[model samples]
Target: MSEETRDEPQEQSLFEAPPMAEQERMVEAILFATAEPVTIRELTGRMPHGSEPREALEHLRRRYEGRGVQVTRIGEAWAIRTAPDLGFLMRQEVVETRKLSRAAIETLAIIAYHQPVTRAEIEEIRGVGVSRGTIDQLIEMDWIRFGRRRMTPGRPVTFVVTETFLDHFALETARDLPGLSELRAAGLLDSRPPPGEGEEDAEGEEATDEGQEDLFEE
Candidate 1:
């Protein structure tokens, strides 16, 4: 009946966000296209001003509950991942690019459990000198990286596991790693005492880069 009233409706329509269903689709498209887990802040930045990405994600996650691919959480981010039970079907497509030696595995485990650890500290725990090559290989794989330098003494640089490591293992954080008791229960650890210094050197030497077995198991 009036110009102001007619214009009011038109103005409201211009600022109104898309329906929840459309917002869900927007989130789905973004999560599908992204290779890494995305944070809510990132989704908010990409969506329309009036869109609610968090609520959209909640709806989308519930909708995908029993699907072959489901929405998953990684730390503070979200991702669309293969359903845990269906992961076997995708394993055949995975390819191992390189191998990790026993030394490398030990070094990685130590750094993962005790992050921000210096080279000297790693060697102290393992009772063996760590080769530069072992550290280099882990860094090259993007699984581990240099952390801050220690404040004491020479300020030796520390090593810590990266997001790639957490993603690969599907862990929310380093705290998710199994404890020693869990490892023993799973038969991953032996009751026998650890090898002596001499035996450790021998194993480390025998499992060189070229002779190492596959590090990634499908």
Candidate 2:
């Protein structure tokens, strides 16, 4: 019934009395520091250690909803993206676009996430034999390419992602690819690694814990 009581809101805000500017800055820091697509879960995990981050992030997203820079979701992941009006800024002076298949996209993601991977490693992750033609297709797209040999017997060649792949993915370089820890955190790998490539397996030919192919698979 008192004026002072009336002035206060009915429901207490989730965040304490922290300055709004500082809260926004913290959100910005989390966004910039993370190399991978961070989710609401990961964002909240990094908050004040005592304070929650969800309400702050939801608040932040609302604040930025229509601004030049906005927080957006892709699947369950989140990222700060430039406004569509600014899409022109990201365009290259020389333009070329490439099309890829579902198989190619799957292969490219495997290579990007697990670089220095070999054909056997890719096949295992895909759970199906990678057509020699699929590799050739990726090569034609200039998105993936061969790396140096693994320095093992027969000098087995390794495969790594190319700079073009990074460019297409809007990343700075291969180092910008999400780390194993980050990938695990995002839960993107929860999906099955496809089906086995199922070639005749010898004792020496199988998948290793690191998901690297066995030594004698060649």
Candidate 3:
């Protein structure tokens, strides 16, 4: 076999995988195009074999540092998101403000404060039956989600605030939520009774199930 023929295979190997810089660009493009965060394994699957997506992602992340857009990690996934400082710019451009109904707002606040709470618990807290539409509205807004069922009789499904809710409020965790005093000070909560005051039992009047009460203690 000729030397040139042997060298042909060597040359082909050099171009088999993209360079690190090109890989970084590829990662950036994928992250930019995706609406949801992409995991390293997902990126590797999408890239050519031997491409170092993890390293490339690190490079891309550093390149975006201090910029208007940044590569951020959510759980095990990565996504290109607006920089924290510049999020207001995008909010101003793209956010459409929508007013929530009083019922929906109250339900959302209750869920946020007492998450992994059962529908029955919510009714007990508000001293009124929670309408299906209110829960549906919050779910449609992606602010609340269904949690695991309680171990009690009938095993009713529970509800909790979603990560989207935390992100929208710029909260790292549920604990970051303001205290009752703060909510009252902000006028989000009122000291006076709601419209139908005498309808239901007072707060904590309904006994809490043993295991269900500690769901959010963590």
The lDDT of each candidate is: 0.75, 0.61, 0.71
> Of models 2 and 3, which has the larger TM-score?
3
lDDT of 1 by residue, 197-216 (tens): 32244335433322222222
Please give, for residues 77-153, the per-residue lDDT of candidate 2 as tens digits: 55676765665676564364444434555566677777888878877876867667668888887767889888777
Candidate 2 residue spans exceeding 4 A from truth: 1-85, 88-97, 175-218
Model 3: lowest-lDDT 10 consecutive positions: 204-213
Model 3 vs. true fold: TM: 0.60
- Cα lDDT tens digits for candidate 3, 1-218: 99888778533444478899999999999999988678899999999987999999999989989998888875467887777676556645644455554556556767877878999998887667787877887899888999999999999999998766665544556766644444333344445445555222223232222212232233
Model 2 poorest ten-residue lDDT run: 209-218
**Candidate 3 residue 44 C-alpha distance from true site, Å:** 3.8
TM-score-better candidate, 1 vs 3: 1
TM-score of each: 0.70, 0.39, 0.60
Candidate no. 1 TM-score:
0.70
